[model samples]
Target: MSEQFHAFQTEGEGTGSLVKRTVEDLPQGEVLIKVHYSGVNYKDGLALHKKAKIAKDYPMIPGIDLAGTVEHSDSPDFSKGQQVICTSYDLGTAHDGGYSQYARVPAAWVVSLPDNLSLKESMIIGTAGFTAALSIHRLEQNGLTPEDKPILVTGASGGVGSMAVDMLSGRGYHVTASTGRLEEEAYLKKLGAEEVVGREDVTPEKIRPLDKQKWAAAVDPTGGKVLAAILSNVKQHGSVAVSGLTAGVEVPTTVMPFILRGVDLLGIDSAYCPMPLRKEVWSRCAGSLKPRHMEETATEISLNGLQQALNDILESKIRGRVIVNLQK
Candidate 1:
């Protein structure tokens, strides 16, 4: 008998299909996971794009995140039937990933799912939420606190931005959500943003060496011009944590913000985060860092519904998180 499971397979030649693949066909790994939930991310959307160069190889399954019960394990660190999560670090890039009903992951890449988070909830807090948490953690590390000045979040209607807004607001920060989707102002306010501004509000009309300092700090996942504007606008001794490149990649700005204002530019990379820090942050996600509206921040979808979700994410039409519920 052969071990068979359903998976979304993408070819390097730029085509994708849902097919039945055998366990023997997956990449080498020590643990076999019975995936309960996965999450869609910007990277997952790009993995389907013909020119994105995201997937490291052909025949990839690009889900980037999953939470599940362990079906088999060769590593002593994890036991069969234990709940676990696998996200980033080549899961959906170079290796077989979470879009499948079953996934095999290297033990080194797995984490025990935090106690207070269910499989569904964990997937809701997937890569995007993790990135947000890491961003906030880095900001606070750099001496950012909830003060009179607000913390600005770019792309605030999207997953990372929305999560950043919720977490910052929950922690008593005055949050200013910057987004092109002004129609989502009510929703952003509901998530605790004190102010919601148009994306153009943060993006400068032209690149200035420096601007009048406004925000105490910012969480900017929309790199490019928006990031440059943020770099220039952050207060003296402030910090801006950046994660994505949704906008154009070129940053047309001068160095005066960092040198003169003493602002810090922090990079948030959740994918290859150190294991110790990853565990600590996950614990925070289950504890004090957990947001008030995680449920409202996410919507669940079945595997068959992934294509539309992928398209929506790529077009920036999707809001908040899209959790994937795998079917056996």
Candidate 2:
């Protein structure tokens, strides 16, 4: 008989409820990983929504990120006892994901954990950190520079936002962080934000065709009216890298920012990103771009603790990162 291991499974029509799972029920794949840690994300919370549109099928796992040691593999590129990380792609969506004691993934979806990063450390950074790194990479690709005034990071109390502030500041870019959680102002500053502002500072009651140029660039994870406001006020020739829609998906705005000021809106999708780029970004997360005091960014939980964790994420009551420890 195949050994059975516990997994957080979601099933039925509508939004699936939390349930237990077995390894033998997982889809066939080239790699079998003994998961050590999994990270909770905003996307994972949406997967629980009846209309989330994130999980393509029922009975799916909802974790988008995991770090572990290989237990078995059909491909020579991976081996037993090797450390690796998997995020985005079909994981936690169309296939079995990281909300389990074990996970089997395609060899192509795996990246060996970079040097100097532990399995727990990788998950602590998780998908949020990866997306933050990608946002900065895109901004720099579009000509954003540290010398170009101050950069802005919206939703700065959350995982991706906090990571962006830390990474940008680590690279010598002055970051102005914006958040509704004013209580976290000191915390954001500790993460290297040169300035911390209230969410209202970036949110405009009346969005004009254009507003006074404020930021050289911005990393925005909360897209909606605030994005429209940010776009209207971005400096000439500046760019905005957007990765989330926690504020809702619709963005109401005009083209003046793009047409007159040459402002570029860069979209960031960590999932489905090409493997070459994925490897490069993770490498940076392990190196110069790694944030200081990373352990301070996460709250560890056990496998049985996912429900409350997911609920907190949906309500936006959780701060920083939430890591699930399978061994617990």
Q: Please report how far candidate 2 places residue 129 from its true position, in Å.
A: 0.5
Judge candidate 1 at residue 259 and give its lDDT: 89
How well does candidate 2 match the true structure in TM-score terms? 0.96
Q: lDDT scores for all predictions?
A: 0.90, 0.89
Candidate 2, poorest ten consecutive residues by summed lDDT: 12-21
> lDDT per residue, candidate 1, 243-304, as tens digits?
99999789887889988999899989999999999999999989877877988889888877
Over 4 Å off in model 1, which ranges?
A: 1-3, 12-15
Question: Model 2, 1-328: lDDT tens per residue?
Answer: 2777778877634344445556677788999999999999988887876587888887678799999999999999999999999999999988888898889999999999999889998988899999999999989989987898689999999989988988899899999999999999888988899899988889977878799999999999999988999999999999999999998789999989999999999999999889999999999999978887687788999877897888788787877889999878
Deviation in Å, model 1, residue 325 alpha carbon: 0.4
Q: RMSD to the native, candidate 1?
A: 1.3
- Over 4 Å off in model 2, which ranges? 12-20
Scored by lDDT, model 1 comes in at: 0.90
> Compared to the true structure, candidate 1 yields what TM-score?
0.97
Error of 1 at 52 (Å): 1.0
After superposition on all C-alphas, the RMSD of every candidate to the true structure, in Å, is 1.3, 1.6
